[model samples]
Target: MNVTLRTPRFILRQPQVGDAEPIARFLNDFAVSGNLARVPFPYHLSDAKAWLRTRVPGLPVENSNFAIELPGEGLAGHVGFHPGPQGPVLGYWLGQPFWNRGIMTEAVIASLDWFFSASQAPAVYSGVFHFNAASLAIQTKLGFTQTGRSTLLCLARGAEVEHIDTIMTRSVWKARPK
Candidate 1:
């Protein structure tokens, strides 16, 4: 869908055809791509275009994806959900230049707030590569608890990596301190 979520620092909107340049530029860095399970390293402009082509509007909220935009920076990151075997899986990434700014935490909070309001799903699933402490911290901060561990293929790394599975149940989310 054409949903636009706003945080105090940035806007989360549907990925656009025009975002290809920035998307490619940011994700091309191995530092950024390496942490993601699905993105390839040396990510190209064409790769960005191909990925953007799949971001069709009018999908259900459970399948929502967003392009995180900063006022002057164009696109700084992305945050979204995709269907997984267990449930709706949340995923996100931020450009290296924007790291340590807490931008992602804000974006995720907004996304989840909207998600829980829009869907009747029982929970949201997410996980981080074992080395991604920052991403895991974000999840725990938002009330997601560890469920177990598994291995996931890292497209950029070209290998399977240990993944820490986490979930946020609807009741847990509703009870979370705002």
Candidate 2:
């Protein structure tokens, strides 16, 4: 897979040693961490370092993550996937400062394009908290259909929240309007 993916206003690149600071900064926020299932509140520098240490730019999407960087801005967020029992699940987050900028939407599309072309998985899946309308809209607009519903324990929220599971099979992706 390519280490660096570019859209008009963003560059999704592999994380380097210097990225820990910015990543820790953005992820440390309650608003950001609250939406993520695994990320804890009060994110620490070590957490960012540990996360970046796991990024393998040249590895498969099932084992990599990217630092979402803007030209003048540093790290805007993260977008990547991890291997799971069900399939390859797509995950992403952006700094609160960068919200409402259509950045995540662009990032998701680019990530999906690369994901579908490179992996053997039959589909890509995403689970969004029911309260997060933005993410729900993003997934729907990108052609993901709800597969089911369940509850997930959110680290930041410290509770089991209603989660909507969605998937975009290879067939659905191909037949969608582009």
Candidate 3:
């Protein structure tokens, strides 16, 4: 996989050894910890290293995980796609300090472009918790349409939750203004 994706103000790259300390710090922030289901509160450098070294290397061909970094500003967050039976599943998160800055949306657009160009997949899907309005808005802005709702058992959150599933197809994406 390519190591990096450059956007106007961000670099979406694979996680490296140098990223461990900053990622650990961001993961432990209360604001970031509360919103994400997988990241533990009080996250440690060991956890970051484990995530980068073990989990990241095993991602499949259809999937990609990127560490969002703003040079001179530090690690901003992460974004990725998980290939599913139906299509690719998109996921992303931004550090609290980077919120409301449109960074994630830009990253998503770039990822979508890469997916369409590189893969055979025809569509991309994203699921946002009902209360995550910012995420919903981002997907909508990227031209995804609400396809359905799903009730998922989130073991990490310890709840049966409702999520709005949105989808964007290659046809739709290709028709959009570039």
The per-model lDDT (C-alpha) reads 0.92, 0.86, 0.80
Poorest 10 consecutive residues of model 2 by lDDT?
52-61
Report the C-alpha displacement of residue 51, candidate 1, in angstroms.
Answer: 0.8
On TM-score, who's better, 1 or 2? 1
Measured on C-alpha atoms, candidate 1 has an lDDT of 0.92
Put down candidate 3 lDDT per residue, 10-75, tens digits, no spaces.
Answer: 888887888889888887786665555456667889988987785456566467888898989988
The Cα error of candidate 3 at residue 4, in Å, is: 1.6
Candidate closer to the true structure by TM-score (higher is better), 1 or 3: 1
The deviation in Å at residue 147 for candidate 3 is: 1.3
Query: Candidate 3: how large is its RMSD?
Result: 2.2
* Off by more than 4 A, model 3: 40-42, 55-59
Candidate 3, pairs of clashing residues: none
Model 2 alpha-carbon drift over 4 Å, by segment: none
Better of 2 and 3 by TM-score: 2
| lDDT (Cα, tens digit) per residue for candidate 2, span 42-87 | 8999998897676655677677677789988888998898876688
